[model samples]
Target: MKTRTSKTIGVAASAAAIALSVPLAVTAYAQPSDSDAPAAEIPDPQGPECGAFKEALPNWKGLADLPVSAALASIPEISTFNSAISGGMNPAVNITSVLDNGPYVVFAPTNEAFAELPPEQAAYLRTDAAGLTNLVYYHAFLGLLGPDDVKGQRPTQEGTEVEVTGKGGDIQVNATAKVTCGGIQAQNARIYIVDQVLDPAEAPAPITPTSTSATTSVTPTTTAPATTTAAPTATTEPAPAEAGAAEAPAG
Candidate 1:
């Protein structure tokens, strides 16, 4: 899929262009904490009996036995993702095949998650098949990634890799998009239903009581003013200015 370059056309051009536009203040996708929490802090949803790598365990119906394409298509929650991946920019760009050939981990965004994206824009990408196709590859990992194995930077069909963090049930993609449901297995792929679509941009990088302390360096405390407000550094002024952030839409 990396060979299928992202074309700068229609909505695709706008998506890529935003990367070089003014770096806006985005906090939605930055690491939730200044530092990674101890592994124990993150919760694992499955009971003690289930382990990440254990044999398929129980999945919805018998999805594990089905082909990756049919498995995902059967799920109602991620219909938007399935629909887009089913089609291509044309016959030449077959994304469905890329996903079908696993062991791939597809981070499928739910319908509500897709709704969070700009309505017109999201629908357009589904048809134009460039912006979302790049994003689809960006979200996919070409191997079977179980809960225990989901951490660390994973390669994608797209050029840029996604950094997955967290433990067990609390796993996240790029340390933002919460995996609402995971460990769904298909014959060739493992599907993870995520609450948020981890877009390519740094989440557009919260909140607190009273913060009047001044520090010379950028130090993110366990508690802070807002996601966008960091301590004023020695060389720069700290205004509530827009700095680059994550994928969620901005007002």
Candidate 2:
């Protein structure tokens, strides 16, 4: 009877050990490995000028189906540029139509940039049709150019060239204006928003002195001494005649 009791106790202990081991095995199998877990997604960093716009348009991939003019018009920051093109300020150049068909790269200046312009220049552009058209054309290029592709001088629709240079994360146009936002895509163009308005015609010509302005020679003037005439003495004349007569008599 004691042996039977000892056997039953051994069986019960074995069953408990097996039950505990089965739970541990199941827990181990259910846990996920590090490699099997999904990776966390990271977002790309935006340019300083585009950061706010990016946040505003979180779903914008690219305006690839829209025309260049329409794409620029959609962005509120570049409203000044949109208005210039579509406002009919330049009847001769149809800027809006030109942009509609382009495989062009456009450097758009912001409303603040226009406001920062010398008030006279901004006013002049608003009224002068041809001048405004040329100004707008100066900012456009024939083909699509991203930040990486923008280097050296590129010709614009206005028949002028814009000097492009890039260093680190910054891009400069015409050696003065910096590209604040870049690589914006449209159906037929790439757009870069610049901090300043680029005017090829308004760029000051290199200072060169004319041939007539050679070294100036100063001629010094000589002043003659004042002549003083002594009061004629009747005695002096009498003295000359007397002296001649005396000499003749002495000889």
Candidate 3:
């Protein structure tokens, strides 16, 4: 009986010791040195350009009101351009080539802005490479201009100039278009959010020469009436004047 009781007591004590040890082992494992654990990874929030502009200026109305000039100039990649102006500007479909440092001003329409243009103009932009390139240059100016800097008149890269004005508490540039909000300063760049997309200057209509037969007919008809009326009136007036003078002398 004594041996059985001792065996039972030993078993109970061993079980209690095991239960307590399991909790301690788990606690030690959980509290391992920080060097033994994996490091937390920080996510990148901004785009490829590793600037803090987006983070610093979270409230800025970026490119929402502006034409597509700044983004087109700054980011050369067409894919980035498409992504940047995805909202209302659809230049992605039409624009195959882009220019930044050329001697031309480009108002670069956004994907949405380009869509808003007439089908003919949009088609021309897509198919006509030389024309599109020239048009882009037409909107560019020599100096870097921000929203604040572009008030009043600005000369384009082309000889022609565009006027800038402020209205309704918004700054309006040429084409009577308004820039709602802007003034984002990037490295060696500035962005303005304009209200309307810019349009390329329209080509002048060709002058067609009149047909030779039509020209001859019009010229004779135009001269005949004046010649006939003038000669007859002059001769009759001289005779009447001489007769009146003779009658007065006799009286």
**Cα-based lDDT for every prediction:** 0.66, 0.73, 0.43
Q: Which 10 residues in a row give candidate 1 its minimum summed lDDT? A: 40-49
Model 2's TM-score against the true structure? 0.59
lDDT of 1 by residue, 168-243 (tens): 6777777678887776667788777788877765522211224785432122336455667678767865676467
Model 1 vs truth, CA RMSD: 31.3
What does the lDDT come to for candidate 3? 0.43
Write down the TM-score of every candidate: 0.54, 0.59, 0.39
Q: Among these predicted structures, which one has the highest TM-score?
A: 2
> Candidates ranked by TM-score, best first?
2, 1, 3
